[model samples]
Target chain A: MSQEIRKIEELARTIRRDIVEMVYLAKDGHPGPALSITDIVASLYGSLLRVNPSDPEWEGRDRFILSKGHACPAVYSALARRGFFSPELLPSLRALDSLLQGHPVMKKTPGIDMTSGSLGNGLSIGVGMALASGYTKKNFDVFVIMGDGELQEGIVWEGALSAFKYKLGRLIVFVDHNGWQSGASCNDVGGCVSVKSRFEAFGWHCQEIDGHDISAILQAVKNARAETNLPSVIIAETVKGKGVPFMENDNSWHKRVPSKEQYEEAMKILGGC
Target chain B: MSEYKGSREAFVAAMTDLADKDPRVVFVSADSLKAARATNFAEKYPDRYFEAGIAEQNAVAMAAGLAACGLKPYVVTYGGFITMRACEQLRTFCAYTDLDVTFGGLNGGMIGGEREGVTHQALEDIGIVRTIPGVKVFAPADAAETYALAKAAGSLKGPVYFRLGSGREPDVFSPGTEVELGKLRKVLDYGNDVLLLSSGFVLDRVLKAAELLKAGGIGASVVEVHSLKPLDADGVVRELERCQVAVTIEDHTVIGGLGSAIAELAAERCPCRIQRLGIQDVFPESGPANTLADKYGLSPQAIADTARALAAGKGR
Candidate 1:
């Protein structure tokens, strides 16, 4: 493997390690979403996004909102690794009075672009953020990380419809299509689960990618920025609990925090940490 | 004391003034331009005026979308529809995330469209929006005060709900009345016997209540609680402390409106005998605004009667 690809994989491993450690310490955090989107976030922040951790609110900085906020561990882990906050602070997740709550809070957490937990509402907020960037002529793109399960909310379509009406070209959405929700797979849950075609029909320039592939993720974002006429959706197919042997592809990790022993085992599986 | 200016004319007037300074101050509405007095503002500033048809929900969602793109958007429609029908959108995208939105709702009471019956009434809107944190709810009593509230709501840091009665509400305050969200304005000062507080479209009723009390040789202090959410605790407690009787009059309902807000404030801080005179808990019957106010015991006389009873230890 090339050095760049190897480095990307290493960063994803570290992010997953932090996710496991934090959830294990808190004894209660959704590891599935975090693990699933680790590579997607790493690719965005590490490679594609035009953001400054030092100047987090820079007028022209790219915006990212976690619409499926329950899976905040992935984004938070990425933010910590991106040097927005200390990686050491990751273990404080879910503690009382900790800045890191179970869900991402815009006011509370730096690098968190919007306060979200309400499923399907995050994209609406993201629509606003993207629109705001366009309105102010800030020239910064807005990114929304949504979940397939969260797509069931009627408000998402309401927002989706508005995004197209405004032709918010800078709006980029990455749907974590891990195929599982809190109940079961998204297909079992009612509503439009075909995120790729849904966006295309909504007039969004659409593409589907393997979410774990850093190179593919980078290419999708670059392609989105190049599109001048319409918004874009990268419906990334990801595996819930992606890396660790026990957690990978498991629905139980939706809100499961790894135990201390399990954490060690998972980290060791990534190779003797 | 400054005359009580209503919010309806006030909101448009403020928008007109803002349109002069800021080119991006856009007003999106669901076909109430003439009633909201936005006709002149629209003509004067056509670029800033956007009529969104008869869709309140779509209008709000569009405003949320506009706000996303950094446009300062003020959405106008009936209080009943804007807060009730599109409440989910308001809560999800606007209030929860603290978007920069100004919602100007008219017919705040049974003020306008009372002829249209229960569906058009905005009796519960103030109470409904008060529950959402971080959003300001302002009800300006008269025309001048309404304009002031509109300016503040427009330039406000976060989301705000500004209400005004429909049509020609009495200009309670003289011209140039100053108002702010979450601040209470005292109208007439009474010594220490009765305190009568009122909100939008009911300042005249409040004034009448005070005069009736004065005729009966009871001093009644009248206050305009324009800002409802961050309830003016200090003003309420101080009024309760000096008063033997308290009466809250509004053009809204018994549940979650102005009366309950004042009563809750009084009960928690300075407990006192209180009579909340407003709409009944049932859907209001179609009639003239004044007729319905009387039928629901919300007129000045009814408020006076209830207050006298509370003053005489007679209300249940």
Candidate 2:
């Protein structure tokens, strides 16, 4: 593996470790979705996105919104790792007056582009940002990370259609297709509707990839940037509760905080704190 | 007080003026351009005006996203759909985030869309939006107030829900009335016997009722509460304290509208025989604006009669 790729992979592992630690300490948060988008977030922040952690609100920086906001731990860890805030603050997740909220709040957190916790809101906000970028003559791209289950929200499709209609080429969405929802699998809850086909019908430049692979995410983003006619969606097929062996693909971890023993096991598996 | 026109027209004119002055200002409508009088804005600033079909939810969220990009976005639609359908988005994306997105809830209250029935009425829009923490809710009584509030909404920091009545509303203030945010303006401060607090297009009715009560030797004070959410508590409470009887009249339902807001305040601060004169917890009938207001007991005579009853030691 290339040295740069290896470094990114290492960062993803650290992010995963932080996600587990944040959820375990807070005893609150959705770790399953957090872990599901770790690599996608790591790839975006580590490689593709033009951002300055020192100047998080720089006008020229690319914007990122965690639409499936329950998955904020991964993005929060990435922000801290990117030097947006202190790494020590990660343990204070969901704590009173802490910068790391249960969901990504823009005013509270430095790197968060838009405040999101309610499902299906991020993409619409992203479309706005993309349109604003055009209006202001800024070339900065807007990225939104959404959960697979969040697609059930009718607003998502509404935003999808509008984004396509407006020709928001800079608006790229990464759907963390981990399959499992809070209590049941997405297919079990809502009938098997191919997310890729849905986006295709909406006229998005849709691509499917192994979400765990950092290189694949980077490549898809590059390909997406090439398709300037429409908005892009990288349907990253991820495993819910990805890194930890016991939690991997487990629906229980969707909202479950790790026990002391489970925390220790997860820490060891993700190369520890 | 001076100029007379439809609040919707005034709202659209003010927004278009803001769009002309500020490049960052944009308007997103849910295919209600004609109803909202935004065709001129769409023609002039085509790039800034977004037509989001009949999707109020999408329009609101899209406006929030636009605000995130440092642009001032105004989401315009009928008050019913804008407040009822896109309510969650207004709370989550706009209010929670404190985005600079103004929600122009056109055609507010029971008298807004005459003959359109209960579905078109936005009686609970103010109550619905007032509950949000960071959202500033305003119900303009006339074209002047609507224009001033709409102009101010573009510059406000966080989310603002500006309630505008449809059709021609009586001129409650002069064209250049200094309508400050979170300040109540006394329209008729006649007597200390009764104080009538009102908002939206119903202020004209309350003022007329105050005149009738004054003529009948029962003095009534009419105050126009433009801002509902950061409600001028001190001003409202002060007015409430001065009178023996208090009445809140609106074009909305008696529950959770101006009446409830004032009653909630009166219950805590000042104890008085309060009469909430509005649609008394019932679906307003479909008819002309005047007919609906009259049928729902929200007309000037009905309000005056209620005030007369309250002043005569009758509990409401």
Q: Please, what is the TM-score per model? A: 0.88, 0.96
List candidate 1 stretches off by more than 4 Å: A1-4, A191-193, B1-6, B22-73, B81-100, B112-116, B152-156, B179-183, B188-193, B212-219, B314-316
Off by over 4 Å in 2: B1-4, B314-316
Q: Write the per-residue lDDT of candidate 2 for residues A1-273, one digit (tens) a residue.
A: 778678889989999999999999999988988999999999988888999988988998999988888999999999999899999999999999899888888889898888988888889888888888888888899999998888999889888999999999999999999998886999999779999999999999999999998889989999999988799999999999998989989899899889999999999988895
Writing each residue's lDDT as its tens digit, candidate 2 over B188-277 gives 778888888888898878888988998899988888888888889999888877886888888887788888888888889887778888
Top DockQ model:
2
Q: Which 10 residues in a row give candidate 1 chain A its minimum summed lDDT?
A: A127-136
Looking at model 1, give its docking quality level.
incorrect
Tens-digit per-residue lDDT, A1-273, candidate 1:
667667778888888878888888888888888898888877777777888998776667888878888888778878888888988888899899988987887667888876777687667666666656765677788888998988887767767776787677888999998888998878887654477777877888898999998888888888988986688889999999999878877788888867668888998986637
lDDT of 1 by residue, B194-243 (tens): 77888887788778877887899777788888888777888778777877
Q: What is the DockQ of each candidate?
A: 0.23, 0.81
lDDT of 2 at B192: 84
Cα RMSD, each candidate? 3.7, 2.1
